[model samples]
Target: MNVLKCFNKGQPLPLRIKAADALRYLCSYDPVSQDIRTKITVIMAELLVLSNDNEFDLINEIMDDFVLKYAKELEPFALQLAKNLNIQFLRIAEELMNFSTTQNNDDKVSKEQLDKEYQASSILTNMNTMIITMTSEKDLTYALLGSVEPSIRFVLENCMANFISELMEILESFNYTMKCIVPEAWSIFDLVCESFDNFGFDYVLDYLQYFESIITYSFLEDGNKAGSNNDINAGQKTEEQKTSIKNEESKIISLVVKLLNEDNGENFADEDLVLFLFKLISLLVLKLGCVNF
Candidate 1:
């Protein structure tokens, strides 16, 4: 359809729209013939240019809608594309994240470019979603306790580790904000704790500091939800369930202790370090009360 020419030559709006449509159709439906792949690659490269140039709102808009609708198909495709493309997708993600931090409206691209960026972003977000789903699907808690696949082992491990690192960075930033700007540090602490309560084991504990500090930190009482009438044990636990939970708790606690020791108690100040130590000890004590102990 001479789509590449339209994008390369920066032709009229209708040509660009038609080019995007043709590219999307060929990539999704056409058999992956040599010509198809070349066309798709060219179209993708052109879209990437538009993404960077901040031109052509239609390109971004169409890409955004296409990616969201086809996320399940696009995710692995994007990952493969990341491996093959001259420019790395992760680097783009990092750049986008950086852009998000600086000028609020700085990365404003044309509708065309925005669609392209949205498609790319949807792929990454899908990976995050898939990781969570896989955990529940095959009961990955059982599989990943020791280790997992060779193909995905490092990538999944890295993904989780990176997420944990990012989460910890957020927590630290929140702490700083609380100390400098907010009335109370409790807001930061509580938010961190809530995240812990919700997504505890999803994080891969790689760094000693985060592993020890948050992953292994004692499950502090949630004051806000303390008296809420929600059913904590709606699903009755079997003996196996109890055992699994206890073991998971023990492993997490051990990981934390290891991390804390690795830091030599130097990361935090003396008073805060003592409080952390106290929390660690309390967690150990709580573990001792469990059936496994």
Candidate 2:
């Protein structure tokens, strides 16, 4: 599809509507071939260029259209793409920093060119916002987890690990960006945790470190504190938010404790998995001196 022709500088509205329809079609339907995916990717690339247009209401319209139409089908793709693009943003930010340091010494590139590059980065970053919403989508999560793409499982696992590592590594540099992205990241974690039941505890254990890294990182950023109600500032956060974070902390700790306690190389029996989790939860409850589900 000639996405360039779909956009007109002189006549924008009709072309914008057509482009939005084309995008929605590309995202929602199963592609007939790899060529279609490539085409859609190119269209997405073009759409990214228009991110800064003053008349971007059509872009919002298309984003909402895709969200409504493929809330399930396109969400995992969008989520992963969003995460991947966000990682790009982090890398680009580092590049920008390096450029700023050297550009002060060089005079070859003009200010306008540097400004264009910065603007391009900002546009890509804003395009990533749509991805954050997809990650938080509840129905989409359920659909992605339930998807049985046996052929793509290995690819998906690798992509997930790489994406998670990239996100964790540069999280400090992009704290505010991550703050906006965290809820969706947690939604992903929730799905990964659920995978324990279907895929087995061992599978979940394989990725638990990444999960803990996110928790620890967020906790550190949020003042490296957990459940310290005694501190005056700690009381400022809502009890629900605190409890939720605590629950996640408890879950991770419980899983780690189970792995350590059952240090035998064999996977735990299904019954054992349940009993282990129950005991761990009980121990945490007792240690905290509170009973809350």
Candidate 3:
């Protein structure tokens, strides 16, 4: 509670920063009693409401991480926070996605690279923490999906996609750059997948269309790639470009195959889900020649 005083208008910038950091540390290590959590939420909300741009960003960072760390303690109020801080939260999501294992020409990590990775890791820390809370409350997952901001929804949905699209991007970049995928990031993805799968057919059905959109990326016919000179690439693909596209396609197939191996729809899910998986699997086999049984 003393940390809350650092938000006073007369507080020194350094003091305020230190106080906020100290509170965040305390919040993460200790399970905040419900009463203290309520006070902190109310205080943080007020600070956000009254802050200028500089103060807003600072306080947002503090409260955002707090919410992420004690997500179970704070999630009951996440929707309210999202509503009030929609743009900042969306920007947070965008920043998290903007992280790349893709380095510049020479495969070396620079100061800028380190800073970006730190920023991304910080954001992902909060996100992964929230995902831990979300995994326990299926309804929280749906609530986040219904966020008024589309980017918020994007974060929630993509967080649950078993990292198929995300891991592909990471793997492609990693393979190209001799980079490594963060093991913790992969574990968060796996946890979300396993948590949702525990919902069985209901989870499958609820997210069916969204999953289909991701799966269809590797299934684009030749006609889909055939376009005029006005398109983004502007003209024909070079050999390297063609190889890159093929490599991406292979990544997509590998991702789908991996997902299927984890998802045994026929055994425990609805028959319709089983049939849908079969049909999708058949198309995949026809395109790729075979899949791992």
lDDT of each: 0.40, 0.43, 0.47
What would the per-residue lDDT of candidate 2 be over residues 202-261, giving only the tens digit for each residue? 344344334434443344225334433322224345667666666665665655565557
What local lDDT does model 2 show for residue 63? Answer: 45
Residue runs of model 3 more than 4 Å from their true location after superposition: 27-35, 46-52, 55-61, 83-86, 89-128, 152-293
lDDT of 3 at 154: 49
Q: How many pairs of residues collide in each model?
A: 12, 0, 0
What TM-scores do the predictions have?
0.30, 0.30, 0.39
Model 3 lDDT per residue over 133-215, tens place: 54444445434434432432344465534223332332222212211112222333344344445543444444343333333
Ranking by TM-score: 3, 2, 1
List ranges where model 2 is wrong by over 4 Å. 1-181, 200-209, 220-235, 264-293
lDDT of 3 at 63: 61
Residue 293's lDDT in candidate 1: 23
lDDT of 3: 0.47
* Candidate 3 to truth, TM: 0.39
lDDT of 1 by residue, 129-203 (tens): 333333221222222211211212222233323344433533333222222111122233344344444444344
